[model samples]
Target: MTAAFVAGVGMTKFEKPGKREWDYPDMARESGTAALADAGLEYGQVEAAYVGYVYGDSTAGQRAVYELGLTGIPVVNVNNNCSTGSTALYLATQAVRSGQVDVALALGFEKMLPGALAAGYEDRESPLLRHLLALAELEEFAMPAAPYMFGAAGREHMRRFGSTPEQFARIAEKNHRHSAANPYAQFQDIYSLEQIQAAPMIYDPLTKLQCSPPSEGSAAAIVVSERFLDANGLRDRAVEIVGQSMVTDLASTFEAKSAITLVGADMSATAARQVYAQAGITPDQIDVIELHDCFSTNELLTYEALGLCEEGQGSTLVDADATTFGGQVVVNPSGGLISKGHPLGATGLAQCAELTWQLRGTAGDRQVQGATLALQHNIGLGGAAVVTAYRPAS
Candidate 1:
């Protein structure tokens, strides 16, 4: 297949919209407009569109597209939990690469409500729910709520790798500080390490500070064929999508595996390896990375899983400031899901947007200098993972 290129990307500040305020369609339209403007193209130029969303009901994409003036193009709605955005982008990229379309748009939007987690299965009393609940209660004391699951993961990391709670807090503090420089980040106030540690504990080692707040936001991007890029005189500015891969594992039975043996990590690593092979770049060649840091521990483990560091050596890298903005490899310069806010479906696209900016040297204060190579990683429910490698246009 031919390689696809990212023509443009856009996102709104991750923040809460007032009650009865801007809805999902509004967010989608705004992000789509911004993406088109960034691409130096008009909305009419788009040949097809893919929208990523989890909670929104049917016709979400149609409603959003209607706001931008309908072109009667093919509009697909995708739902894949946190990996929704990346999945949509993947399909769009495939379409362009297959010569099915010249230019396609991938948009992700979410407006999450704050509350207890609910199973997305059809029947609330389904046997699947019972089985999942039993497994969650067996290994982890609490039902596998997102923040709680991450906390359990953090606790396991501590036990196995000697990762201190303070070290995890430090990750939160760093991201908060980075977010302060990002006007688009949801939480812009910098938090001290002590402040992060002092925050009320949501789940045993993971404090409130470490948890990503429920957010409402959107992100969008345009992917184009190489021929389209050359025809539009955008080759020099485009970001090359060198590699993309996705993997899935048994989610409900994850607890049966040892804490140190993360199926998600293995799946993500396989995807990353494929991406690296296709890009002809090693982990050391990556100057910037944006991984799913829904919690601090996730970020640390991701380092090892992505081959950025050896297994059990992730904390050492963090301690040495190797993943800081100016470090050997800048991770989450957009503040990540930690401080950048996680809007479910919007997050994966947000990561891609941030990486694109980094590659173009347009990340402002959070910019990583000379970021020629970048990576974006996203994980989904049931331990699915996707990794994509990118390089700046020569």
Candidate 2:
């Protein structure tokens, strides 16, 4: 297979919904131009483009790319809910790896409404109705399905492994502390565990600070075949895509009647297993990670799903400070969705940008020391989870 590498990446600062007067196209232009400049390439060099956004019309990709140039290259629009960004990245990588395109651009941007996520299409059949039905069978449905699903998962973890809400609070606290060093983060203000726990509750055991807010942002990356990299003298600056996998809901999602299963934990584990096997490395080898932390609960559940710790023992990792700087692994050095903000469509590519910067040793104060290997996990319930591993080109 042809190897693909990320030659350049850029992202606009994640902002609260309506915080900026700009629109999605404006954000996309800023990030896309920055990425091209970073790669020292022009729009014409890109053979194809994959754009991801959740709340946009059919041709949002074309409109956004038009800001960069009128090259008339293939511009594919993509939407995979919260995983949309990474899904776009996955498609671009595959296109390059298949020798279908020597150079491709993967871009993601979002201009979300201010509040918790809600179903966009109500009149038509809801895609998540089945998942919601399964949840209703196990526990009463909570409004704003996101926090409810993940919070239920947290409650299950507590019941099974004796994990405390305070431990979950610690996860939020740690991510906020990490975000303090990240200029691009949406919420960089530091918070103590007490403050996190005491914040207004959004869902049971999930405080407002612990939940990723509705955000607006854009991110872009230039992916190239090794041949293209060599031709352009970009090998020294490229970050190689070592392994990647995307998994969706399995039968266990509904059959288990477990909050963890319903929230896509099994899918995450499967995707991580695939990535580790393909890369010939385990979770222990990853120096940095940016997993889906739409809420602190999911972050804890993901610790076990990603093999960072044993199942049901995510709190132990938090208690030991193992998932922070100077520990077992520096998880979410970019502050994650919780503190950095989660702009559904932009999230996955934002993770791509952060990991790319980390591998290149260019993440300023948020840099993870000696970060040679990085892992990213992005998921969209209803549902899909994409896990990818990256390393600096040798």
Candidate 3:
């Protein structure tokens, strides 16, 4: 086995669904070509590719990569729902680390519909049926499934830890402010906490602004073996992936009958523990992070899961300004899914791209000062949680 590094990263500006006339392949071509250009490598140098998209047909990965080049290399298609983007990245990094390929391309894109997310197939059984059933056993809701699950989590946090709706609204306020500086974020306008709280409610504690919207975008990264980096004199530009872990649902997911558990708090906590141990670092040592924020409630729940704060104390982190820029750790400087836009398959790589830029001191206005260590957390209910740590290449 060998070390793997993210040599280059790129992304298309996230857009409102239906705002662009482009297809998935076009989005992939733009982001993939930008990544290769960033790495100063040709598409032909990529020995393998993993492309992720949830709303596409078979061979979509091949079609998308074909727009970049017909290098005749192996292409793997991935669809892990919302975590699909990061899952592709995980596979690509593993390929380089395992010495199966000196360099690999990780690409993800999604062309989504303009409104709330819905199941693609109502006829067949849904992969998330089990997750929903778990939710049903715990509580009932007449609202949208995704929002209810997260909102219920918020409700649980409030019930257990005394967190307030205002605290969750503050999270949305902070992310919207952060997105104002992000050129690729779907929503850049900052909103007041009062305004956010006053927005049309999607679920009890979750307002429309508090939940991530359906978005369309693409993001890409080039993973290279240490040997490849040295050979190409790319070490100076590489960001080493020092630690990574992926975990799925556990017995705690449903046995506890807790919304927090059902929405992957346990998986996230388990994966983060593994990642921290693997990287030989602690949450306090992470200078920046890009965790999943599909809903603001999940962000609060993740705070405890990632060990950034104690369980039932996530609100303190928010109240103390410990998770924002110039705070203890800058989390979601990219505006996260809420504002950056959750394009499902593209989100994980988008976070990878953002963190890679931060590590490289190239994040422009949203840069976290002295960011030597970064963390990424992407989760998809069904469910999978991928946690990774990145640091400047040694």
Candidate 4:
């Protein structure tokens, strides 16, 4: 297979919705311009584009990309729930790797409504309708769908394993502390574990601080083939996409009747394993990571899923400080969705942008020392997980 490289990445500082006079087009133009500038290329050089968003109407992708230029390139609109941004990235990677296009753009943005996520088309048969019904059968649908679902997963982790709510709060604390150095993060104020645990509880073990707030932001990345990189003198800045994989819900998502599986732990694990195998890499080789920490519990759960530690040992990893700076491997150096903000479509691409900067040793204050290999994990609840591995082209 041909190789694909991330030549550049850009992201907008996440903000509360309606806080600024900006619209999605403004976001698209800002982030898109930054990414192109970072790559030292013009929009005309892009052969195709994948634009992702979750809240807009049809052709939102077209309207957004038009902000970059009127270039008549193929523009594909993508929406995979929270994984929407990464889904565009996944397609962009495939486009370059498959030789479909030498230079492809992956752009993602979201101008979200404030507050918790809810389905827009309530009249229509919701994709999660059956899921809600099945969940009721499996576990008590005690709280709102998202929090309860994940909180139940955390509870099960405690019931089966020995994870504690304090451990979960500690994860949030770490992410918040990490966010203090990220200019793109939504909430950068450091919070103690006590503060995190004391924040208004969203669910049993999940606090309001643990949940990612709706955000307005955008992110973009330029993916190119080796030939294009060499031709454009971009090899020095290129970050190779050594391997990538996207996995959907497996049979255990429903058959096994476990909150952990329903919330995408299995799918994430499966995707990460495939990416590692495809790249001939291992978790121990990943010096840095940017993963889907939509909730702190998911971060802990993902630890085991990504093979960072043994199953039922995520709390132990947390205790050892193995996931933070000066630890085994730096995870979520960008503060993750928990503090960085989750703009659905933009979340994945933002992770991509952060990792690209880390691999290039340009992450500034949050730079992960000697980061040779970087891993990305992005997952959506309706079941999609995209895992990608990156290394410098040099």
Number of the predicted model whose lDDT against the real structure is largest: 3
Separately for all candidates shown, the number of backbone clashes (residues 3 or more apart, or on different chains) is 0, 0, 0, 0
Query: Model 2 — which ten-residue stretch has the worst lDDT?
Result: 114-123
User: For model 2, how does the per-residue alpha-carbon lDDT over 100-163 read when each residue is reduced to its tens digit?
Assistant: 9999999999998987777777789888889888888877888988888889888888898999
153-229, model 4: which lDDT tens digit per residue?
89989998999999999999999999999999998999988899889999889999998888999999999999999
Please tell me which model should have the higher TM-score, number 1 or number 4.
Answer: 4
* Candidate 1 residue-wise lDDT at 277: 90
Candidate no. 2 TM-score: 0.99
lDDT (tens digit, per residue) of candidate 3 on 1-394? 7999999998999999888899998899999999999999999899999999999899999999999999799999999878999999999999998899999999999999877778888799988788788787767865578898899889989998899999999999999999999999999999999899999999989999999999999999999999889999998889999999989889999888899999999999999999999899999999999999999999999999999988999999999988998798999999999999999999999999999999999999999989999999999999999999999995
Q: How accurate locally, in lDDT, is each candidate?
A: 0.82, 0.93, 0.93, 0.92
Q: Give the TM-score of candidate 1.
A: 0.94
Can you write out model 1's per-residue Cα lDDT over 1-394, one digit (the tens) per residue?
7779999998888885453378888898889889999999988899999999887888797787677667899999988878898988998999999999999999999888875445667645642343345436535557436665666667777887898888888888888888887888988988888899999888877888887887889999999999889889998778999999887764524554544334256777788888999888899999999998888878887898899988888889878888896688988888988899888889989999999998988889898998899999998756568899999765
Q: What lDDT score goes with residue 162 in model 4?
A: 92
Q: Which stretches of candidate 1 lie over 4 Å from their true place?
A: 17-20, 120-138, 250-256, 260-263
